[model samples]
Target: MLDNTKRQDIKVILQQVWGYEDFRYPQAEIINCLLNKQDTLVIMPTGGGKSLCFQLPALLQPGLTIVVSPLVALMENQVQQLQQKKIAAGLIHSQQAKSDRKLIISNLTQLKLLYVAPETLLTPPIWEKLLQPDLMINNLIIDEAHCIVQWGTTFRSSYTRLGVIRDALHKHKQNKITIAAFTATADTLTQQTIIKTLRLKKQFKKFVINPYRSNLQLKVKTVWTAKGRKKATLKFIQQQHNKSGLIYVRSRKASELLAKWLREQKLNTVAYHGGIINSKRRAIEQDWLTGKLPFVICTCAFGMGIDKSDCRWILHYHTPELLPEYLQEIGRSGRDNKPAIALALISEPTGWLDNEDKQRSQFFTNQLAKQSKQAKKVFEILPSQGNILDIIKEIPDSELALGILQNLDLIQWQDIFNYQKKSSNKNINSVSTSQQTKQMQQFLQTKQCRWQYILSAFSFIKEAKDFKCSKCDRCSLEKPSRIISNK
Candidate 1:
């Protein structure tokens, strides 16, 4: 029941302001949902027109659309772009000047949109204003929704206060003020967390477009050392030119070290981790957008709202612990329909005291990485490479141990390298534990359909009108494969 005339009205506004016509597949559905004044959750892939889904809905709605975000630099960049289009927009994060924010608040009722960080959403006056419909109040939006999960390191404690944001807005409007939460990476668990934290109803509809990118080829290489991984990364970049990419690592030190190393080899690149100041990060991001830099080697902190659509290489120099995060990072590339590749260069756990233990997993415990400290040392005892029995003898309880290391990137599986029955019927250890280990290893070495494996895990498939990648290793080796229905 989406009205086509409203879309044309939006297209005319878009052309006059932002210059665009027509909506991408899910955009109209999102717009129609927002129009219905419902509380909605949008699970979509990166570059699937997520910003437009919220932007156009904000424009068509009667009052202002207040967006709650966590990325500060992203807010400034997006607000500036909208302002250039002559759209009435404002940003009210903590970093803004006093007078500027005052002006924005004064015109809140009349402005089209306002981008505020979670910090601002907690202010007393901000909440007081929201309690009145006379102020700019039509819809409430929260971006980067996965951060709300209870087990997220990226989690913002203030996000738990959003139940107040909605409560105040609803107190005034005779109608239920519309609410929509959007994210490029969130599983069913995280999705449920979003609704619970925001305190919405089971009746709230869900729009989950499965996590699948057709034009991407997934590959994992088991290197023996950090030195080996670096060599592989440089060689791949040399083979592909005029193509953009992302390289992720566990430590800020690693991010800096790799950028310096890549530059030493004459590749134009920069390091981007959360440790940098906001202004510097903004400057670096601006340069990347304008083509001044070729690659960004970053920690997990980068790429929240970046709109780079032409990146072709997404490299994980180390194996990422969480599969969903890995999915999000690699999905950043090949967004423009060109062939892209995700390479995870990895090896077994080294008997060394690396700083990885301090960087991640402080707040969250992934399924693959939940075990006791004694069990984890088994990773070192198993040696860099070993068979299942070899692993079990060292740890004695590898089911718990191996899962921890796999989630922590201390060990990674590269295909079902080999399997042999020791006794006449020892059987291939077809128990659930072995099956899980086998599957995890398979993900490390899958060469079938590029997008099917990941989506299948989450019960998602690809669409017919999606971008296709004929040059990917899988597509090159086989006929086109049909991913299941994402809807």
Candidate 2:
């Protein structure tokens, strides 16, 4: 617990830095836990003030706080926000120039906080710099902590290797370093995966507030064809005209097509996805933030670090493959404690769209299993140090294979893509991806209250049964039909 003086200091800092008079629920407690150097995990919903929990502690602590984030845009946005408050902050990522990164590293000791991508942090240059005797890193924070479970297994393997980072830093630092992981959406499986993958201390504290928002109405609509889905989405947007909203699609092409179609309907909108150039992506994000564009058709790449509170509606043109993703996307609405609506348009099984989605899930599951086996074989045969091309010749998709090896601590990267073997362990774990897909499909097809299904899916059983929110489509259907509008 914080002493009276320290508690007073915290409030003073909060008011001075953020211009807020008080801490949100659990923010003060989480910050206190970090100040006491306890390993902590926070599962707060989007726009729940998760950043301040760490940002305030980083400001109060003496040494630098290293924040491991997933996206460059997120890191840049955070650093920019801190800089606006005149806080000493910097970031290093792949998009940054070599000279700029070098400068940032050289001034590490002068910074209160530094945000970095996981892949960048694992590279030899950054890791070696962090180990330097003069630098003092007090905390290692994993923002968007769910990504460690979501992407660590398949996409970016560096996340899995984060469990060793604290140990590595401990070897050089005289004092113990604290680790804090924060995310907006995580279920039971994801929470366990984060704890195990990060290897957080046994005494680590967990702060999991219920992610449900009573102000947001949840609904799912079944469309028989692609055209029907588009028409339904357009109708929702038209009904919420002049209000800020987001339309989530699965692919870059879908984002473009939908944005174009919406524009043809006289709605001002833009397409956003990973495929777009960084400059254009930033411009679109700015336009949406400033209300120049009332809506955006985007892939999953657009949500993180965005702080728009008055976003009145979120439409899912297609259901996400996983429930956690759907929750995170829809949680973007009603952030200001005002009424908002989230609707998902899922294709009926009579059409090929739903089947294609199932097939895509199965394909990825099989592919991951096959790659895991091949990666183990390649690990057994590869030399201690060699070119990536040599490994690629022996194994297809060798890059992902090497990433898995690196994550398991069997190897270390000397540069961005070069690896040096550290161990010969062949113990590989295969992740089951089908369960999440099944759950998503179940949620889409279930006849129960939409909010209740979501609550149960995330393991809030009692709340699921006791609180129906009365605003969801199912509950609303039990009453008179009423059109959803911005309050």
Candidate 3:
């Protein structure tokens, strides 16, 4: 608990800085926990004020607060907002010029907050600078921490190595550093992965706000063909009369094709995905934010850390491979507490008419299996114990493969750069890749309220047990007609 004087100080800063008179439920407590030097994990809904929980405390404390984020867009979005408020904040990523990063590093002690992606943070230039003797650091925050669990084993391998930041940085510093992780969607297994991967202390406090949002209505529609799916999505968007939202697809090709088709229909939108350059991606995001663009046809790359309220709808051109992803995508809607709709389009039961969803799911499954085999082969070529940095010089993707091995409990890092293999016969990819697909399919076919199914899938059992939402498609008296018609 915060003392009244400390509490009042927080309120004054809040009012003066962000113009919020008081903190939302548990936001104050989260800030207090950080102030008291307690390690914390916060699982709050999107738009539920999670950023403020750490940002406010960073302002209240003394040394620099290093925020480890997963994406450059997220870091830039946050750092730009902090700059607009005239706060002493900066971000470092691969996209920035070397000279700019050097300037930021030169003034590290002056910044109240520094946002960085894990991969960039672990690189030599940034890592060496942070290890300097004069630098004074305080809190280390992992924003969008769920990415550690979701992407660590594959492309974003640096996430699994984040636990090293605390121990390695603390060795040269006198003051103890605390860590706080914040995310919107993490189930029990995901929560454990985060705690274990980040090596959160056993005493760390976890604050979970129920993820149920009453203002967001959920719906799923079955389409007989890919053409019908696009038609249905177009119909929904046309009905919105240019309201702000997003159309989520699974691939860059899909996003581009959909955006082109929508434009042919005279809908004003653009495609957004990782394949595009950073400058164009940022411009598209800016256009959407300013309401110049009504919506964007994008992959998962577009949503994290985007601050857009009053987004009236979210349409899934293809069902996601996992439930957590679906939850995170839909979370972008109804952010301002206004009624918003999240509708997912899936193929008919047998997928005989349109196998897009089935094909996409199978592609990912095969990819995961291939990666598992690659990791095992990489593990075989490794010495009994050695440095990862050295191995990476000789072996391509050794870091990613090692990360997958570590995730599977076949290897352990002795320090930031060193690892020792553990004896194990457990098959790589033993963790069920299809379980998520199965769960997502169940969500589409479930007869219960959509919100209840989501809550249950996310391990919010108590919330799901008696959950009854009057707004979801399952609960609403009205029903949507089938997407295909006999002509």
Candidate 4:
């Protein structure tokens, strides 16, 4: 519990800094836990005010807060927002100039908040700098904590090595550093992975808020062909003209194609994906934020850490490969407490397109499994220290393999993309990727209310009886369906 003086101080800061009169549900309690130097895991939906849970506590604490984030854009956005509040904050990413990065590093002791990508933080220069005697890092925050589980094994192995960082920091500072992890989506498996991989303390506080948003209407439409899929999407866009929204596709090419098609229809739109340069990505985000671009066709890379509150709709041109991803994407809408719609356009199975999605899922799983073997082989032959280019000759996937080995403590990175082998002969498994894919496929075909199905899948049960969210297509008979003909 917060004492009267501390509570009063929190209120003053809330009003002065963020202009919020009071804390949202559970925010105050979360802050109190952190103030008392407790480790905590916060599972709140996007737009549920998770940032304040850590930000306010950092302000109240005595030392600096290190935030580990996944994307460069996310870190930059956060640092800019904190700076706007007159807080001393900075970020280190690949795009920053050498002089700018050095200045930021030298000023770390004075900063209230520092956001960094895991890959950059684990490198020698930054890690060594953080361990210096001058800086006092009181809190270690993992934002989008689900990535630690979802990407730890395959996509970004840097996340899996965070537990080692905590241990190293403890040894260097001679004190236990408090940690707080926050994410919008995580199932039982993902949660367990986060706990075990991060090696969080046993007494760490856990908060799992139900991710139900009554203001967001969820629906799915089935189209029989590629042309039909396009027509259905266009119809939705036509109906919602001039309203700001997002269209999520599965690939960069698709995003570009969709954006081009929408442009031909005389709608203001843009394409966003990893393939776009950082400066252009920043511009597109700004355009969307300022209502210049009414809609953006993008891959899953678009919405993390973006705080656009008035987004009225989100259309999924292709269903995501996981339920957690689907939830995270749609959660971006209705942040301002206004009504919004989340619609997915799915293609009905035709002889030509049958099992296309399932095949894609299996192909990705097979690739991950193959990478595990490659990682083991590379581990066998890697030198005590070497350049990345040399190792890539022996194993084409050495970059990802090195990350996996580093997480297992079999290797230590010396500089950016360079590693030294610490031990040898470790076995790694690609955990249940296929199962996750199947779960997503199940979601697309389920007859149950979409929200209820999601709740059940995430192990959040509010009532013993079946509950239907009447806002979804399955439960609402009043909502009309739009089917585009194959012709």
Candidate 5:
């Protein structure tokens, strides 16, 4: 009756079920990319309606949407959200009860979307099962697709097997299945890896949103001791307790200790980190989801699959190993489109992790050179732009070297990206590239506006412009304990 003949089922689902009347920016574009049957790589920033790009298309397309997620927490968050809308979303992860898993798979023949960990997707049995042509998996969606590319610092070994899974899925396609890859963070180097790692065709469709949020205030402070970190962290959280906030640390033990210490000061706080038992973590997540918890202190393990759209503040206790990781952390805050604050708690951390940073550049450079056998020598010429072939003569296969370069995040290609070989050069510039990496290291080392630099790396330039935010550490060094009682 409503021109159902040509109207997409997703438009109906969004209106009738999810209670939405419109799609966000890039949602329609990503859905169209899938409808056209092209492999796509999406780089929409956080809170930028990434889910609809896959969900709407999966509903419109013929078969199941098999999603490869990086975190178990994300799987839970997405599954619950879908179920709330009465959409048929299922999950396959280690945490699913065996009976539940069987039921989901049995009903999977009609499943609109099925989410699974990439690690689970790589198993031999799973590979065999996905090979069935009649099984009807029309879409392959890899969330956090950056993990597969080398450009992302938080690389997971599971992502490497996507190529294997892709090849197998293609072997039995009765109807062409479209692969959609999505992530929030990627430099030029990572943009290339998303397509290459998934083993998609060289000419993949791309949707890249400039990573910028003008509503957030960015700040960085350099402190020398753990006590300084706690004093500063507590002060900030108290000021904004009326709104949502998150504090991140490196260790699980640190998360628990900090949570306990904060509550001792009589704050409405809870802990969320990987070291907690799964049941406890779920409870914490649920509590936060229901708005029962006002603030949380966590580790890097948090926020992977979170859908909370109300966080107003995020703090980083220390800088991470890579820019991609930093992007993921900051992305968690301000999902509601309101003004928020992001803080990086910087200090010269001692121990092995520090030493690892000192040599990490050389470590990755040598690894990439080996992988890009022919391109090894050609990487030396700085600021010299050339084709992939000119560069790949030293490191022949465009595929392998691209994979290695993607991991290192050295260079990104033009839109409609192809892994080309570059011209010959005198040497590789591992040191210079590593020096650029020091931008992140110096972020920790410097006392400047850390937020501006972090946001800019992902190309969020205007958000950092129009200076004098007046809300950062640089704005209030001697201010009183406004942390509490202000909000």
Candidate 6:
């Protein structure tokens, strides 16, 4: 419904700013939805131009657009990109100098887009500025929207409180704020969870582009022993030679050990994880981006908002616990629309000889249960209504407990700093993570076309049916098995 003038203006901006002559599949429509002041949920693939959809509309609009992102690196990367385009974008993260953050806050009206982490968004200075009457805000965007459902109930509790943003910002009848949630991967259940948790309007525009990336070849190799697993990973990396890519491991410890071993093997790689200092992490990212380091042995911490267009491959040292995560990680490859491959190594069918995946699943499941029990205990002692700041002082892990309670609908946040307990008949279930892990395990063992299974798992069932991807290992009979045998 974008009229001629508006559409033409957007097209001009697109060419002038991003150098894109035309909008990708649903990008034009999504931008139009936001320009019309409608809430939107966009499920587009990683390289499917998700950012432009919101970024374009923000340019065409009258007021500042706020993007709530999950990682510091992501926000910084995005803000940097916008700045390179000569767009006035700013990000407020912990890494920024105090004076820099203050100046940005004071000059908010000058910015087209303000990127912030969910946790940082709730802090007093930023929150107060947002609540100010003089500020003219237009859209509040949630990037990596799946994290709300995946991590909201556990560690990133601030995401659960984001529903208040809509109500708080829209207090004025004239200052309507549109919310748009965008992510590369989300199943039907995840989509519903995002819609409900973010409290998107009933008539919010939903655009789901079937997350089928035909350019990325999907393959899984089975290893029968711990040594076989190591050998297979090394062999795969050796095959890739000097091609830029990422090797995803499950733990910081593993990242360190594997990275060291890979270096000993004369491979250009390094360890990357959240535990590393920001400067070092930034350096590693820069090296990878510039192809100085061909690959990095990393946990899930790397590659959120990075734009390495020619990344040729992705190797999973440990199988991901969830299908969505698998999708998101592999999505890092082939951003330039060229061919790429994602190879995941799993223990043989029995998991008797090599059980790293089994061990990881058990460790995470146990950790979830322990956290749930602690949260429930804290919930029992918490007053019916209390300030989160005060409760955090009196109770250990209260924030996580409150997040779990809020996620279960057992507690309603009256505001960012306060909550009201609600009666709940059912207990909090921690088995959800375990069930998700099982789904990934099933995916590894499935004989069907890997891409087809992915399409079906992500709710593109109609496309999945009779969808035999000739590119996958199953459908391509000429390619020999890559399985690393114990012998």
Once fitted onto the true fold, the runs of candidate 2 whose alpha carbons sit more than 4 angstroms away are 352-370, 373-396, 402-430, 479-487
| TM-score of each model, in listed order | 0.76, 0.89, 0.96, 0.90, 0.76, 0.96
Model 3, stretches more than 4 Å misplaced? 478-487
What is the clash count for each candidate, in the order shown?
A: 3, 0, 0, 0, 31, 0
For model 5, where is the 10-residue window of minimal lDDT? 478-487
lDDT string for model 5 (373-427, tens) is 5334334442344544344464435434443444444444431122233453323
- Where model 1 places Cα greater than 4 Å from the true spot, the runs are 1-8, 150-155, 172-175, 349-442, 445-450, 461-487
Instruction: Quantify how close model 3 is to the true structure by its C-alpha RMSD in Å.
Output: 4.6
User: Per-model C-alpha lDDT, please?
Assistant: 0.67, 0.83, 0.87, 0.82, 0.67, 0.86
TM-score of 4: 0.90
Candidate 2: lDDT of 320? 79
Candidate 5 residues lying further than 4 Å off, grouped into runs, are: 1-10, 150-155, 348-437, 444-456, 459-487
Residue-level lDDT of model 3, residues 339-421, one tens digit each, is 99999998998889998888888898888888888897897888889988899998887888998988887888876788898
Local distance difference test, candidate 5 = 0.67
List pairs with backbone clashes in candidate 1. Answer: 14-19, 109-136, 368-403
Clashing pairs in 4: none
Tell how far residue 46 is off in model 6, in angstroms.
0.8
Q: How big is the positional error of residue 398 in model 2, measured in Å on the Cα after superposition?
A: 3.8
Selected candidate, larger TM-score, 1 vs 3: 3
Q: How far does residue 123 in candidate 1 sit from its true spot (Å)?
A: 3.1
Clashes of 5: 31
Give lDDT tens digits, candidate 4, residues 344-380. Answer: 9776655265444545566677877787787777777
Predictions ranked by TM-score, top down?
3, 6, 4, 2, 5, 1
